[model samples]
Target chain A: MVHVGANPGRSGHRLSAQAARIVFDTRQGLAELFGVSDSRQIVFTSNATAGLNIALHGMLGPRDHVVTTSMEHNSVMRPLRHLARERGVRITVVAADREGRVDPAAIREALEPKTRLVAINHGSNVVGCIQPIAQIKEAIGKVPLLVDAAQTAGSYPISIERDGIDLLAFSGHKSLLGPAGTGGLYVRPELDLPPLVRGGTGSRSESDQQPDFRPDKYESGTLNTCGIAGLGAGVRFILERGVETIHNHEMNLLDVFLERLRRIEGVVLYGPSSTEARLPTVSLNVEGKSPSQVGGLLDKRHDIMVRVGLHCAPDAHRTIGTFPDGTVRFSAGALNTTDEMEQAVAAVDEIARS
Target chain B: MSSGKHVVLAFDSIHDVIKAEKIIVRHGIWCDLIPTPRELSSDCGMSIECRTDDLPDLESLRENGALEWRDIHRPE
Candidate 1:
């Protein structure tokens, strides 16, 4: 940030060019991380919600039907609801199993002749169940698939091409290890979705109209070059260590944590039983204790913090029968050690017992 | 003034200009990212300046799909 604080692509000066280089490197780095062939296909956004908004609002029109699931966060739900109210768009929400697993056949059955897009949450933020994205692609033939990878971008293995994902929205802060306000959307090169915002891209200065291009089409105004620089370094760190290695490490921690929690008398766990089918996030509740109460105790007494309540996905909370009140989610990261997992589990056990 | 000694390549996007600059420099050719010359039509604000001696190399890079440019100009 100190090095490249200048506005990228705004001028032909050395500092501007340096800032542009940082943005370009970050773009290339993200493309590499997501297994995208063309880096230009991805455009920076403020966060995953913004990316999802672009994909949702830009592509869907009045009377267009979209197929989604109950496992989606408000990032997908709120936008679709707005589209339905404002543009008269139709939506079909496929229900996931109690474990937050969406069936591919259910998704295929939801598709209509006028279905314009199929949007799925790649991983449920509430339950941590990883959706069967590639299999869903085979089910819904030519309809474009938009995968919201907000919770799984760097934590899970995702290849846009190999998975047949038409669009991907990811958050850099969660698993990509970048700072907040850094995220992006990847549009398949063949799909020409219109820009959500347009003004100055530092290109086509002679023309008053917005330029028709890969990135500049979606990316308008000055970008968060400083955040992108950090994102680049974060993605670089992930690439150097390898995603599979990180995933395996987190899974190991999760295994230890879940095993200990399962042995507790009053604790009830949510999501898949196997580690392979989920991210490192675990949701649970203790008998006779509200989620917030447990969360507060864990914070003030044990010095261990966890997210409690609905987690912004009311439908997911409803699916798991934890609605109105929610579950206390213990999210494990790559840096979390097995010893830390044991300590956390011990803390939870103590809380449940009391 | 038409400077026959140097060639300026204009591109459609800053991405292409930066990419072409990297490929050109990596090929042992000297180039600088300059503002697009007034005489050339370009969609981007930046262009690359290189010696005329490297023109053949730039052409080869384009043929090999390493570089893409909208116009070539020699400004006086």
Candidate 2:
């Protein structure tokens, strides 16, 4: 707010200095969280969707073959579909199992000789199953791997070096505890992912050409400096708390919720039964009640909050046989406690019975 | 304009010039971005101005591909 209320913009030391600090702190913080070697590789975007768009538009083009999955959100699916319609690019979608798990080997078989990129979600926002990128990377060979970490970023310990993730798009609002409209991607220094939008970057005021740099090349126009300030603080908070500890807290809550939830009569759960292979996000449907009804009852009567409906991954619902109706999403976050989990279980059990 | 023999590096684009400013400033070098003198060229872009003694350092920057310059101009 200090940055915004103070009238920050180009041609001033206050704004310029704040920009520099935002660059330093946010980069350093995200780099530390993701285990990136250099902070320069991080480029802020409006959201993970925008970052994914930049990656897709910048890397793939006509005649290039891309491999993705049926479990992708519209963010990835819509862009690829647009490219398919307009650019004549070829896309092969690897199908996930009934459990919403993609066989790592099947992904390799789907890889064509001309496959330019393999874009996958680190974890499904709808089904809540974590994709095994480490295993999938071993099969991907030299193809670039783009992991959408919107669901896993601040909640999971993801190492680009260890996981062999080539490009990672993350949302600051989700797990990083940052403001909305604040997110970014970490591009490998050797790789050049071109800019999706081009204009003045405040640096290259002379020529109309975009600057050919890591960040400025991709990040053109005036940035969300205030949101970036909040994002920087958010990342710092994650670092102080330690990602593993946060993950443990969320996982423990999941353990209790799952143990009680599976025993409830008429309660049907989707995705992995155990939380070990996914985020703390769980999806389920009660016996007789619709997703909306359950969600309404939870919110109105129990004062519980959750994301419901297709969760923006329709294909994922189809994979798990929940299309059209969707499921109630009980996602545990950084601040959610075990007490809340018990209450959530009891409420769901009550709703299932009533 | 200023009565001194200064080193002004001409760049192809504004992005290069801004990057040059950031790189130069980070290395403890004091430089100012100013409009190209009207007598110098018709490009109508900005240049990074420094002391004539900074030539070796500037040349080194150019050698390493960090800075790209179209030409070096010394106002008479």
Candidate 3:
């Protein structure tokens, strides 16, 4: 609010020079986090959904073929589904295994000559399994890869160039620790996708036609300058602390939490075993109780916060064979203490015994 | 002698000039956000100025994609 208040343009009409600097800094910081050279490749959006939409809408058209995965959240899936129905875009969904793992070979096999893009997620929200994106890139030679990094951006390390990702979309609120309604998409410099919106950019004001450039090409109208300032702060915090350090800390805590919880009888843990490099998210069910019931018990009785239900990834739940009744999701953030893990594990164990 | 040979960094907008200042300063060089000299640039209202001695550091920052500078000048 202060950023917007200090700046004249709330909806992007007349922005004070200060807010623009923060926006650029925010993009540059994110680029550094992604291990990319140019921050100009980073474009802001309302959220990852909007970012994904910008990529899809800009890249996909009638009869354009796209290859995606079953483990995708509705953000990617729904957009593709709509494109298929409304725009005649053909889609091939690579099936995930019972463990919610997609075989890169399957994705490679699904690709056809007409395929315009290949979309996949870096991590699964439900199963918490990390995908080998680089291997998948190797499988699909030169097929532009669009990654949904919503679950993995801040919690893990991603290198756009190293990973061979063409376009990457990520949410700011989840792992970036920024305010909601803030996120961005990174498009490789050589690649140009159509703008999501075309409006005032304070550039080429002489002509009504929107300027075709990097940030101006994609970002039209006023942006969430305040949120972006906050997002820049969030990225700086990650940078100063180190992404790998935070990731390692979260994984270690998850290890301790899983070690304690999975051993309890009647506790049904979902997703990959502790052997895999996964997010700190753990989903489980108490044998005789509902997920919501167990979640409530953890919250009310143990003062633990967790997300329960489908987690906006129905296909992921179905892949794990939990359809209507979802698992209780316990996500350990960067700040979670070892004691909190123990208390959460003890809470689940007590609930399981009851 | 090199102090007179300064780099001129211009942008498309004042906000971008401000962004350039932040990026340059963060990289450890002191840059003055001055009014864009008409002779140096027709880009934005503001530009960044740094001593020519910092050229290598500026080059490294540019290589790292610190900011996309429009033009640079060295006056005799």
lDDT of 2 at A200: 65
Error of 2 at A245 (Å): 1.0
> Which is the leading candidate under DockQ?
1
Model 3 residue A330 CA deviation in Å: 0.8
Candidate 2 lDDT over B1-76, as tens digits, reads 3745686776644444555677888767778777666554523246668877777887788799766667777755
Q: How large is the interface RMSD of each prediction?
A: 1.3, 6.6, 6.4
Looking at the true structure's interface, with contacts defined as alpha carbon pairs within 8 Å between chains A and B, what fraction does model 3 recover? 0.17
DockQ of all candidates, in order? 0.63, 0.12, 0.18
TM-score of chain A of each: 0.99, 0.96, 0.95
Worst 10 residues of 1 chain B by lDDT: B35-44
Residue A249's lDDT within candidate 3 is: 92
lDDT of 1 by residue, A120-180 (tens): 9999999899998999999998999999999999999999999889999999898899999
The local lDDT score (0 to 100) that residue B7 gets in candidate 3 is 68
For every candidate in turn, the CA RMSD to the true structure comes to 1.3, 4.3, 4.6
| Model number with the top lDDT | 1
Off by over 4 Å in 2: A1-9, B1-76
Instruction: Report the C-alpha lDDT of model 3 over A26-111, residue by residue, as the tens digit.
Output: 88899999989867788889999999998998788889999988789999988888999999999988888877778899999999
> Candidate order by DockQ, highest to lowest?
1, 3, 2
> For model 3, what is the error of residue A160's alpha carbon versus the real structure, in angstroms, after optimal superposition?
0.5
Ranking by TM-score: 1, 3, 2
Candidate 2 docking quality: incorrect, acceptable, medium or high? incorrect
The residue-by-residue lDDT of candidate 1 on B6-76, one tens digit each, is: 99888777777777787788889999888776787555777888899888988998899887888888755
The C-alpha TM-scores of every prediction are 0.98, 0.84, 0.86
